[model samples]
Target: MADEHRNEHAAPHHITPLTTYIFVFVARAAGTLLTWFASTVDLGWMNTPIALVIATTKAALVILTWVVVIGSFVWLGVLFVLTFADYLTRFWAIY
Candidate 1:
């Protein structure tokens, strides 16, 4: 009777498959390698955008796998808006 009572109070067990873990790890590694490779080449104006895209992809993977807070995207959106605003306000394109 005591065993049955203890069992009733026990938390449920969850098992994540090894394959899923392996896949995420491999993908993260590939992303890192690609970022390094991108740095070695000279694409002039395209470099910054390429790096940002790769970094955002890696951040998405990490957020999806670990972070539970959905509200964090609000900050990210704010940052993007401010960055673009600053970018647009620059007058360095003067003739």
Candidate 2:
């Protein structure tokens, strides 16, 4: 029985090609460049979200796994919610 499940633990995975790695690296580099460009141009309320999206994409590429992708979105959502939550509390006067 253990041997039957052994293959499940050590399942054969797809091997990644060098060119595929190079492409992902290029994509990550492009994401960084786009982030810089976005920073330079003021997009008003649109800047943070766009930057977060680019950063998350780059982060996802670092591992290129579904777990990383899901985690990235969760991370993004946390940051976005916290930022807006703080933004929403900037006007209190109860001293």
Top candidate by lDDT: 1
Estimated TM-score per prediction? 0.57, 0.54
The regions of model 2 sitting more than 4 angstroms off are 1-10, 63-95
Clashes of each: 0, 0
TM-score, cand. 2 = 0.54
lDDT of 2 by residue, 6-51 (tens): 6555757676778877888899889999999999999999999999
Give the range where candidate 1 is weakest over 10 consecutive residues by summed lDDT: 1-10
- Compared with the true structure, what per-residue lDDT tens digits does model 1 show for residues 4-94? 5566767886666788678778888999899899999999999999999998898888788665556777777799999999888989778
Against the unseen true structure, what C-alpha lDDT does each candidate score? 0.83, 0.82
Task: Give RMSD to native, each candidate.
Answer: 6.3, 5.8
